[model samples]
Target chain A: MKKGMGTITAPWKQLLLNALESNSHLKHSSYFQLATVGCNGRPSNRTLVFRGFQESSDKFHINTDNRTLKIEELKHCPFAEICWYFTDSWEQFRISGRVDIIDGSNPDTFKLQQREKSWFASSVKSRLQYLGPNPGLPRISEHQSEEEVRLDPSIGPVAAFCLLVLDPDQVDYLNLKNNERVKFISTLDVNGVKNWTSERINP
Target chain B: MKKGMGTITAPWKQLLLNALESNSHLKHSSYFQLATVGCNGRPSNRTLVFRGFQESSDKFHINTDNRTLKIEELKHCPFAEICWYFTDSWEQFRISGRVDIIDGSNPDTFKLQQREKSWFASSVKSRLQYLGPNPGLPRISEHQSEEEVRLDPSIGPVAAFCLLVLDPDQVDYLNLKNNERVKFISTLDVNGVKNWTSERINP
Candidate 1:
């Protein structure tokens, strides 16, 4: 077992961080599933792609379109839990957190830099609501092609309604092997400091 | 848009069913993150695996250790939405549902079929307890080896406690593409019939 600075020092934590850092697949496509309670008190969940994480700031960022039901609900209630897990590895990170929509400056510059030209163009074009199959409908271009679209300027409106910043409240780490299953529970204080403890329970 | 069976078109409904059916990677995982509300009214999510799904019954099942916090709170509140999304396809499914503990003969059969051989061995060896590191302590074995442990009829006690079943109330399908986004919502009525509708949404 290795000791770490995050108030939780266990083998699993180190393993988790290593997995997150070393696995490009996890970084590339890990979707943060956000869960929120609807007006009727039922739970709701939506997938938000994992954008970036600032360890020093202890904040994670994700991009979302402004019109999602999740965004609408978050306006009414900002509390949510974000979850990510790797299918190949029996490891999962569940973050319970409060969400805030960040509409300042141009965060899309960062997102644009991370994406390929094709992906960025596709994303913008798709934003026009033209991908679905509708019989006898005229087609119109919604976005500029890769060569014509300018990143610096394109970042403005995209960033205007793009990023979601989550300040996690608690995190649960679970690892399951053939015989052993390990779990760690880490609760975050109001200041976003984590206090973690471990418990082994029946699998 | 094409119109057919019970509010949802045959093509779209087929797409929804195929998305869930063809995804073997999603099915084999041991745990899935379930988002719920904590006692403090904060969002909480934890990983639990896909147990089984009954097409005939239109129900999904997942199992968890009896001692987890979510299980305790779930007894008080059964409303939750389960989210599962595949990274490669960016395909997402959100199931709004009610949770109930499965017991009796059906649950017993489900447990035996769903649990891997290693899981049974771990339970037999001991109730795994999470203890902080003790210097020079002997390593405890959760299971001797996979082959050494056989399914004992005596293990029925532990088997009875961990089954959970979710009956979906509504399912939202989000298919994100480069040019447009397609959204489908399906609600299950009291008589266990499903009604679905689709609309194009701005991404």
Candidate 2:
């Protein structure tokens, strides 16, 4: 079959939803590798949890700390990609997109609202990670109370808390059961309108 | 403890070996995400299988088709990172390194020998993938015979078969079991000797 294009949003959203449901039993299914180009064009990657999409749109959500190295890397280069694998169905999704960081310094009110909403939606344990000392910093003591962390749900996101929204331009969906692959590409027009095209490719 | 410096080789090799032993039951534990920078500084990522280290050294091995997109991406930018997550112990390793591609065109017989050895080590199914049409091309048929593919192991690597050697300079190991993180940095001295330093860090 020929490639098909769309104008509204990412075409792989439905397939991704199906995959998520199929592999809901695995906790790490939501965990994916977020890769960014660091200083001097070196590649940096880390595992992060999927915070779901914004409403029904393809704009992805990920809550991170501003003090993390990725924040600095993203500041230098906004282009990034996330590679996610679902072991149950043996599905792999490589999504390449441009990341927009909404931190304490962001001026966009709408983006800030989304960040606020994400922070409140997270579990107390998840929110407490942001409360801890900056990631990668030397740990002074061994005891970090996984049991004692208590954050007020009403309190908004702290200063270090940041939200990353990835506007995906391409997605490579591969199923290892048969090693079937599909590529979905999205291009923008002059007025900033996104058009998506999907094609079945050899694995 | 404070940071440690080693002049011989990567200190994290022991930890990685321990991880591999602990998660030997899970098949996908051998899989990880490899991220590379594409044109215009964009980031691309995909899943790949780990082919173990080179003898006692930390030099990583991965086999890929030369015609794949990463071969071109690596040509422009050899810097890449592989993020591996172990589900059993909740450990993640982020290894950032420069990749050396040893394809058919490679001049070094030594590197080509390694490539040949890797091809011989791979299964018949893996070897047949390279014989198929180029990656990302439209699939002409849906049924690709998964079985009934046989190749003699004594034969050498095909022209499309390529070996990737990742010489890591930095490794970030995070154990979510206790949220304990360690940063391993390797610096090359003037004589091309690598010195590794490790420090306990916050997750």
Candidate 3:
């Protein structure tokens, strides 16, 4: 992975590295808009949290249960664009990439060994059809103990519908106040050699 | 316009009306991600500032120089989507609407009279050709004096692309918390009337 401000030498690799090293605050950012194409040819967007980034494999992952429309649509087409912005710093990054869904491997013993407990809990609760408009809908507190909820079989790899792995092809960075923006486009040939070209934008 | 959360009868209408009011903070919001369709059948997204909103007209406006790529693409196909989320509130709104470029009238003379001076200043600076390598750059130096930059008469009305209105056909509201996430999807017809039936989904 390479890193620089103006022209990205290795766009995808550099973005993966920068996203990983991004301030801890950014890592925890809750508002990321993902744009995907719908069957009607219109774009669909929804906000998702920045779950985490994996450095060694150079992939950014977000977990969603099998039920969400986005995950279901991705099963048919995997191209997507994700945008992340830090409101305080007026810094924004846009990643356009393809998504790969992981289902066979055990998330607990994943190559990165990064386990998201909250994601698991949410997935388990989601599968129960426990969510509805009424207050009487089953509550997490009523059914399972905290420990049981944490270690529930349904909350692990089996519970997850898909693990979205983003392989970025381009990253656009913009600093609002400075009025500076850069576009880094990545190119990888059949042999797997990767290259990136960066260009400064008039912001 | 409408008021009160429960005052609106239909669920879809209530959601869209609430979104319009809930996102009022967007009037003061500096950054917005506007997603449009590219000629290649891919979705394209970029950031813009929220200029103002006219409740009576049910229009949300964004200020941009006429020369921008967004403006160019918008002229060909006016459909677009805008997403906004506030930190203080976990509420996030996605509005998919249409863009209408108004050129004959002074954009500032519209609903944003309170911010005319600031808007005028920005309009002047934004007319300058961005020096960077990227296309359709954002405006730089919010503090730059409008007096220093000469406005080109040819670029007067046509130069400022005001109020990319989104007549929302569909809106999705996502409220996320530590334990539960509530998602609602509402769809409307071309006349902006709600379809009444909305799906509550597990996120």
Candidate 4:
């Protein structure tokens, strides 16, 4: 499997890798806006915590409840986008790609290993979300706290855990400090080797 | 023409109205991520400043340059969503709605009036964005700075200013402080009058 951002030669890719690796801004602001296509061809967006980023293959990693609307939306339309903003550095990254869902049922051990790693990485407090009632549905009760539900004997890992792999085919980087924005479009050539064409765009 | 965040009886509606109206957190961080559906059936998102919020009809207001890809995306798919997070209050709001784009060619005076008001509301620095070369396109020059581009005599508003009205049909509010989340779904019943249903979801 592809690993660190070291092998990426493209400037935009290098920049994104540096951001995610250095933990300057991307690390501090772990949450990003996730956008998905609805059945009616519209977009639905919500904020999700950034689980991981791998620069080698230009992939963003996030976790979600399998029962959420986003997962259902992805089943119909797997194309998705994620936008991240580093407020301290005044930089914004818009990553667009087709989603590859990796759940416990996937045949590949790599995906299963990743899912297990994510589960272990999550703290008790964080894991409580997945253990509680399904997202977007009515709450169990108005007064029940998340911790209470998590502590309930009936709840454990709560079967709805899934890992989403967003393989970015396009990355748009905007440096708002100087109004300099750039885009990197990835395509495979005749050799089937991935390549990216970068250009400076009007902000 | 929804005026203010007043007259909304639903608890989630009232919560959103209060947040936008109070401006404690929303005002401090005026920018939020705007998500749209691309023709390729994928999602695209970017950060844009919040122009206004009218609670009466659950509309979120924002402006964009007509030449941007977002306008093209919205034209093909009018359904969109916006995600706002008030860091200070630890509150996050995900709003989904249909878009109503208003431009110079639009006939409605109310929309036109709103557009004019937005124009008047913008500062010279803020208006420079519309004056620049089309967004997502190649930059005008490798050496030209945004201020230099703004000061150029040839550049002006370029008639690319547009107002986008997001008439929300669903709203999800999550309070990270206590892991309490709620959803407000707006529907039109047999009478064709808008009504909202509120529910507390497990976070």
Candidate 5:
């Protein structure tokens, strides 16, 4: 097992990492738009914070509340696409792949460990978000929600705190400078080995 | 016919207008993520510049190159979604609905007039994007593509200039500060009368 993205290097992954490094000055650079097919059969889109790369692998990490509509949408369709735009470099990366939701009920124990790692890795302020009232529900009176939360950080992840991992199969990289574009594709062989191929295309 | 949104108004529309007004200082605020169902039965996502509201109505205007993959994807399925996030206000609006592509071949004369209006409304640099080599094709070398284009400004929009109109049926608005959310839904009756209903939802 590669165990990490250490030896499993790809040109696009390095390029993405470089883009993130260059654009780290802007706080919004970590934000991306995630698109999924909703349960209603319509395309649904939302903004999500990129948690980071997951365990040194090509997969991306994103934390979400299990109770959110995206959870249900992912259940209906696991395939999703995310568009990340780097303002400083004038580059856009559109990654399309399958999303695996690792929640409390996930049968894989190792995956659950990663969930807990992500939970504790979050700041106290971020962890408090998962302890609050469910998202997308009618807002309670401001006074009521202002009360202090009693979530214990050492107790592991709360029920609502879930980790989402996007295993990308295709990447469309576009740079506005000089109108450059590239497409990176990942294919799995019969033995379940993944291979990456990249091509430079017109912008 | 209500040719414009002059007499028609909705709470969500007003809120969206306010969000845009407050965030206009950011150049990237005008950019949003648009997602469409690809012909391959997967979700396709990309970043696009928002032209503005169509006429004075609620429909959003977006310009695209007719040669892009989205043009073919739209033909396969017209449903699409857009996610716009405001940094200053920390608000997100997810708009989902059917898209109507108005290109050179569109039969609607009124829409063609709108297309022309959009063409002239764009700056010279913006107009040049459509005059280049076909997007997504293999690059033919930097020297050849570096040659100046001979596009005539007064000749109007080129064949590849296309205008996309998204008449939204649903808007999911979320404000992260106080964890407030609202759902706005539009339904059309048998008599072709459209009605909008809004509800405060959990955040």
Candidate 6:
């Protein structure tokens, strides 16, 4: 593990924090693959931008269109997994978690605040994504270009904007270059304090 | 889709084949994330090397340890998904598939032949992966380095070596640059000929 990472003492958590801090892969790219199980029990995966990470909460945040099929699938089954690969470090992190969708109506003040902050912080191009036709729907024209679809005057943000917060139950961090792997399992107590149990595992 | 430069005709398949041909991400790195459902119905994902692609059969092959939790997970549920992000192109492909494991003892001659060919094509470093300690097991010491663990003379190829073939039922291709997404669903006819149905979808 990277040394002197005093904020997180646990090896697995430290490793993850280290990757997020210094890894060029994570630094340059905000994208990671998200996996979720459909109602039919099939696993589906797609690339999603990693919006935020809270070390204390062991939570990951990603922005998605509320109308996407994955969102519908997540509604039926909250179980989800996300994988981030750091090419420069040859490290991969697999996080298994339960997803909670936070729309404008979410009761949690902190979460609602986060959603609002993130929504405003996002660029017009990014916000335009929520405005476009419902994701995964078939297009009407083969000749319809992306720019045309994106810039269509009729497009405007509706109520489908959503923030998905994943509270990881288990996180597996693998350093392929080192041939070392570590797993961190997190639990929250009655007081809402989070604790992590970590162990070094084979790669 | 790049047209008239013509090899693959199908737009979605052409995009994938083009990515494989020219994308620096796949060329410089062999790893892609694999997602599968655990017996309990949670999704799990990890990075694995992209060993081979059989275009004619529309299948992908990856070699892995048979004893891994993922292999066991695949046993319980054949449904799987893989995600590939091409950094240079800013494109991502999400492939949803059914997995089949093939070992040396498989009945099919063609599969056995492919295994042997792939085994011989692999490097000593790649071969050493199959010889390592069982994946996901706790390590004895924090000081234990990868080289020490690998150089252990006792380590050698075991029955754990296995090949995974993913027959994708659906492939979703997303080009971030263009903000365009396409879905290709494959079907098998009575004559055993595979066909693809492609449609442009919202990104």
Candidate 4 residue-wise lDDT, B1-203, digit = tens: 34433355545666765665655543336778989987766788999988765435556778888888888889888988888876556678888888999888998877787787777667767777676767787876788654775344333234788989888888888987777788888887685556888778766
- For candidate 2, list the clashing residue pairs, or say none: none
Candidate models: Cα lDDT each: 0.54, 0.86, 0.55, 0.75, 0.86, 0.74
How does model 5 score on DockQ? 0.77
Q: Write the per-residue lDDT of candidate 2 for residues B71-118, one digit (tens) a residue.
A: 899999989999999988799999989899999889887778788889
Worst 10 residues of 6 chain A by lDDT: A1-10
Error of 5 at A189 (Å): 3.6
DockQ of candidate 6 compared with the true complex: 0.68
Docking class for candidate 4: medium
Q: What TM-score results for chain B in every one of the models?
A: 0.60, 0.92, 0.58, 0.83, 0.94, 0.83
Clashing pairs in 4: A139-B200, A139-B201
> What TM-score does structure 2 among the candidates reach?
0.92
Cα lDDT tens digits, model 4, A1-203, are 43543245555766875666555533347778889987776788888888765435557778888988888899899888889877666778998888888776789876777777777777766677676666777765666665565344333334688889887788899887677888888887685556888888888
Q: Residue-wise lDDT of candidate 6 within B1-203, one digit each (tens)?
A: 21111223334666777787776444434568898999888888888888877534557889888879998899999989888888777778888888988776689877666666666666756776676677788877667544543433334334666778887778889887777888898776685455688888877
Per-model TM against the reference: 0.65, 0.92, 0.68, 0.87, 0.94, 0.86
Q: What is the DockQ of each candidate?
A: 0.28, 0.75, 0.28, 0.73, 0.77, 0.68
Candidate 2 Cα outliers beyond 4 Å, as residue runs: A1-9, A142-150, A189-191, B1-9, B141-150
- For A1-203, candidate 5 gives per-residue lDDT tens digits of 43543346656998899999999998888999999887877778899999888775788899999989999999889999999988789999999999999999999887898899899988878888887777877765555552487766578888999999998989999998766799998988676666889888878
TM-score of the A chain in candidate 2: the value is 0.91
Best by TM-score: 5
Query: For candidate 1, what's the TM-score of chain A, rounded to 2 decimals?
Result: 0.60
Better of 3 and 5 by DockQ: 5
Q: TM-score for candidate 1, please give it.
A: 0.65
RMSD in Å for all candidates: 8.7, 4.8, 7.4, 3.9, 2.0, 6.0
Candidate 1, residues B1-203, lDDT tens digits: the string is 11121342323446545665666565433234577766766666665666555434545666555556776667667877777665545566666677866533344554444343323434453423211222112325555454454545454434334556676656556655343444555665785457666665433
Query: Taking the tens digit of each residue's C-alpha lDDT, what string does model 3 give over A1-203?
Result: 22112232344445444544554464335457777766665666766666655444445677655546676557556877787776656667888878876653545445223334434534455534322222212233433323343344454444444467777777888776676677777777574655667777565
